[model samples]
Target: MSLVVTTNVAGMNSQRALSIADRQLTTSLERLSSGSRINRAADDASNLAISEGLRAQIGGFRVALRNTQDGISVLQTAEGALTETQGILHRMRDLSVQAANAGSLDDDARGNLQSEIGQLRNELDRIAGTTSFNGRKLLDGGYRTVFHVGADAGHTIAVDLGRGTSAAALGVDGIDVTGPGRYGPGAVTLSTAAAPGTAAVLTIAAAGGSAGFSGGTGGVSAYTDLDGTISVGGRSFDLASVRYDTAADTDGNGTRDAADLLAQLNRAAIVALGLTSPPFSSPTPGTLAFAVAEPLPGHTGTAGAPLSASAADLARSTPTFTAAGGASRALTAIDAAIERISTVRGDLGAVQNRLEHNIAKLGVALDNTAASDSRIRDTDMATEMTAFTRTQILSQAGTAMLAQAHAAPQGVLKLLV
Candidate 1:
């Protein structure tokens, strides 16, 4: 090599090598400090983006799992309430059986039994109205609760817990007028109640209809869909867009003796059909008693003398349990109520099971996703430490070589001397 003082080519090469070593050492330190290889986007931009997405998914799964847990808890609350209602119903059934033994019991004894039974019915109504979860009603047929089961849109589960405790919903609110044989003597009563000069005699049955939301499925579809024409004042009201429940309607134009006619009346039941309030009678499960207008253009009766109710309209409304055979009717109503509670509990159990599975699946997914994200972004401590050692040795050697190269220029001074 030529003796050069001003231009030190060897020094320049040594400095370049040192810079490379220093850069490697710095990268190793950064990984050690952060415990991650991709500390910055520059470290691995593509992989950083991928890991970030995985992190987002993991977070969502965690929240979704919690939501599923909450849904299970809510279902449990509802199931517990139904269990208690079932006990109350069982007791009521026992009382009704005791009351039905009219041959062995006196009127006063039966009346006492009936009063207790009435209180039980009130309790049922109370449960239906008060059972709730986080302020949402459970058994009033109103809770259509939902849970998030997955980390994406449209990934959810629903709890369709309908009115399991309501007297009307359970078919327990009235008498067992589902069958003609179920009626006893005096189950129906008819008397003259007419506007001045009107001599129409009206009759009302004490037993309710056989058809209602009775089956485990609630025949809810029947209650929902009702498309029919109810003639009032010689005009009609369209029942179009009623719901899916009334599709299997077995009412209307049937023989007067047939239960179908009564059931149809029950489905298209009218509560306030009077021109004015001659009297307002609350419905009994198997019976109805109220005066309605004659529906004549100008002959509608006043409040004190409302027209006799249309027989057709009277038949359409739900029936109540009659005073004559109320005990036997109560037994039948209790049975139906018990069935409804069981059905609701079973449905809630099914939903809870599904939610448990959802939570477990979410946990597994989160674990696996974390593993994948770790592989994409986590630093290999052993491998990074090895690189740091190599760079440290290189840096020291480069410094020594730079000093030697700078000293090489002193040889040029020897030549000059």
Candidate 2:
């Protein structure tokens, strides 16, 4: 089996040694240049898969972090608007207090005070309409915008800072684009219809609540499921249910009657005005139906249509001022608006806090992802360099021995000679 002339073991050993050396050198070059052992999929399929996943997560976390910062900016802007709005409310409250000192004032004095109060209200509306950040209105309506973190995997949060949709429009919806100087009273007045008894439906679209004419045994109870309080005049209405448009027959009939509707409103106003004590008395069984009195023949023409007051105005006109006697029914509307602002602010605060927590958690996630990717693909330069040096020396020694193997055939040629 030992054929010295034909068979060459040194050549075979040399070739095998050279192949091993070339493999070591290629790995060293890869580690040094690319800084990764897993440049190709065949290197380590499982580890490559894991590293890619971690890298993707790291990229996503970076975007999420930026989004968190954006959320913070939005919150700060909203907070600023709320602070200003709070100041405006305080001023309005003080004016309402001053207006209530009827003993020290005549009709003219009270009217002048009302004009100033009206002006303050108008100013608030102006501020609310104009204040904005990043092209987004912060105080006016349509500020309750929803933010989605991602598709199904992420959560949805609100970014807009206006009072809830309900209070902003006073149960109205959608954006108010007219921008200041348009809103006359806090309440949108429905002008007299073109024709009488033509059925002109004036609607106040209830937002974030269920308010309807409940003709059932239960009297009228307009509910707000969201967490907050709304004061209409001096009466504080608490919303505990999220449902809106629940019918609590304000008209008193098993069926709805528009005239009775106003009467019910007047009653509620009286309660809000603090004319009636809390836990309002239930309507007597089979009570007289609501009747609309005839309009006054003529008023001593005043600038604001001051007509002769009537018996109905007597109950409804009672001041429902707060314990400090600073609150009024007119002021109650402002209080409702203020409460809504605070509730929205609270909601924004909650979202900001949650996002901040998420930002911290995402930071940790990004760090861990980077570490995992490094472990999977990064090479130890010192270890690779040492192996490369050993391979270089072995390859050179094998090349010299291969030359000696080539000369082994020459010995057989000399014997034959």
Candidate 3:
């Protein structure tokens, strides 16, 4: 090698090595301090991309876990309400059985049983109406939703609680369990002389029949004109719009008979005039009895005033246990209602089990995904420390060698001297 003053080649080589060593040392220190192998895109581009994708999946799994938990809670709430409803049904069933024994029970004893049943039915309805989860009704026959149960879109579980558990929904709303029971008091008889725009005379009577109205002397005439508007409660209906059953001309009187008129009045549209229950019950083929004892559902009006009932409420008014034959019919109805409730409860249980399984699956997925991300992006302390030591040693050695190379230029001066 030539000795020169202008440039010491040995020193330049040592400086270059030192620079490279310092850079490696810095990278090693950063990895050790941060505990990450890939702190930026420059560290490992492809691995960084893979790590980010795994992170997204992890986040999605966390949120989906929460959603699954919420779904389970909603189902639990609905199931709890159904449990209460089942208890109420069981009690009502016991009453029906007791009332069925007409030979052993008198009218008063059966009446007591019927009273309790009516109260139970009311409570059942209240539960169905009020049960909710997060302000969403769970038992009103409209609960349906999806829970995200996986880390990806379109991975979901659907939950649906069937129709409802109300007394009406269960087909036990009007169970009487008493033979020949009068429709509870506060019903008005419509007069044959009732004309449109004239307030129908409201008479309180204890009519007797298989279903509350007896063939009695006081009743409406079949030929009474019903082709105009009549007001009930605070609403009006065009009576001419009433759809009389074309097939119900029982009297063959060349015109619609009282039975046809009664059928029209009981039509869902007319009954929806705001009463809590159907307003009209027939005592005979020609007589229409109106019930004004209670305000319409959600209505707070005084008794005896005209009101309306929804079609749903009307369907709930089927008489039960009012006579020997009625009691037999009620047993069948109660059995069917019980079966329906059992089916709903079974569905809820199945959904709960599915949710629990989904949670387990999510946990496993989260663990495996996290491990994969760690492998791609996290530092291995043992391996990184070894690299750090090697770079540190090279840095020190390079510095000493650079000093020796700088001294080589002085030797060239000595030769010149």
lDDT of 2 by residue, 292-406 (tens): 1222223122222212222222223322222223334446666676777778779778888988887888788878878888878898788778887888888888788888877
Question: Largest lDDT belongs to which candidate?
Answer: 3
Q: List model 1 lDDT by residue over 1-417, tens digit each.
A: 567678999999999999999999999999987989998899999999999999999899988988988888888888888898899889888888887777787767876876776787788889989988888888888777567789989998876887557766776665322222222322222223334344333222212323322221322123222323333221233333333333343544322222443344434433211111222232322222332322223223333232244333443343232123556666766888788788778888888888888888999999999999999999999999999999999999999999998998887666677
If both were scored by TM-score, which would come out higher, candidate 1 or candidate 2?
1
Number of residue pairs clashing in candidate 3, backbone atoms closer than 3 angstroms, sequence gap of 3 or more or interchain: 9
lDDT head-to-head 1 vs 3, winner: 3
**Which model, 2 or 3, shows the larger lDDT?**
3
Q: List, residue by residue over 1-417, the lDDT tens digit for candidate 3.
A: 676788778889999999999999999999999999998999999999999999999999999899999989988999899998888888888888888888898889988998998899899989999999889998988888888888897998888887877887887875667745323222211222444445433222222222211122334222322333334422345544543333255456555444545555656434434333444554333333334443334323233332333333322343221122446556766889888988999999998999999999999999999999999999999999999999999999999999999887887667778
After superposition, the stretches of candidate 3 with alpha carbons farther than 4 Å from their true spots are 181-327
Q: TM-score of each candidate?
A: 0.67, 0.60, 0.68
How many clashes (backbone atoms < 3 Å, residues ≥3 apart in a chain or on different chains) does model 2 have? 22
